[model samples]
Target: MDKHSIEKEFTALIQQYRNVIWKVCYIYAKDRENLNDLYQEAIINLWKGFPKFRKESKPSTWIYRIALNSCITFFRRFSRHPQTLRLTESWDFAYEENVFSSQIQELYALIHCLGNIERALILLWLEEKSYAEIAIITGLSQTNVATKLCRIKEKLKKMSNQ
Candidate 1:
């Protein structure tokens, strides 16, 4: 594709999948600044990887892979910046009506308790991705995805009740 066509297609794709990117970033990053930084990095990675997209999977699946990978890379780089260290804060559930919001925040916290990349895997699963799709995106088996998701749910429930 020429530059203009590529840009157009990229814009369309971004419009379609922006929420997926945002949710992935929000799940991993604590604050707005880090969320924006992670979002930009994911966008850059998505643009770079666009040409390699073979259309074998849904576009959302492709974008999710890129977004999650970018978040992992960002975490690694951010961890190395000693001066940038900040204490992680737990989500508050003071507003009872915001149960969904509180659940999501609590879910993010629970995911963080998992092993490094496992957190990303569970986030993708909670996004309601099918096991086959997740396996295709993460290069894991459907059975593996199912098993991990089961474990993740139990962990989240246990944490939320605490």
Candidate 2:
């Protein structure tokens, strides 16, 4: 396709799935500034990978892979950023007020304490993606996704109790 077509298609898809992008960013980001940076990075990564999209998966699936990978990369490279580990307190109120109920807001707090991949899995799970679907999006086996989610749920229980 030509440049204009690519840009137009990319823009439409991005706009259509922007909430998914933002949710991934919101999960990984530590604060407002980090959210902004992660959002930009996710968008750039999506653009760069757009030309190579093979259409073997749904667009949302493809977008999830790109956004999650971008967030993981951003976290690793900028681990020392003040906002890097700020996912909990900063988002607690915002989530309760604007997004999640108190129950899920607490879950988000616990989720921040988990590793990047685990966090991604929980986010996908919370979004009600099937184990097979999450496996495809996350590049894990369906069994592995199930096992990890079980462990994550146990961990969440432990964390919430304390």
Return the top candidate by lDDT. Answer: 2
How many residue pairs clash per model?
Answer: 0, 0
Per-residue lDDT of model 1, residues 1-162, tens digit only = 699998999999999888888888877765667778888999999999999998888899899889988988887877753222112455432222234555555556666566556777787777787789889878888898888888777876776576
Give the per-residue lDDT of model 2 (tens digit) for 46-97. 9999999988999999999999999999988879542323324546235213
Report the lDDT of model 2 for residue 143. 93
* Candidate 2 residue pairs that clash: none
What are the models' TM-scores?
0.81, 0.89
**What are the Cα lDDT values of the candidates?**
0.76, 0.85
Q: Which predicted model would earn the best TM-score? A: 2
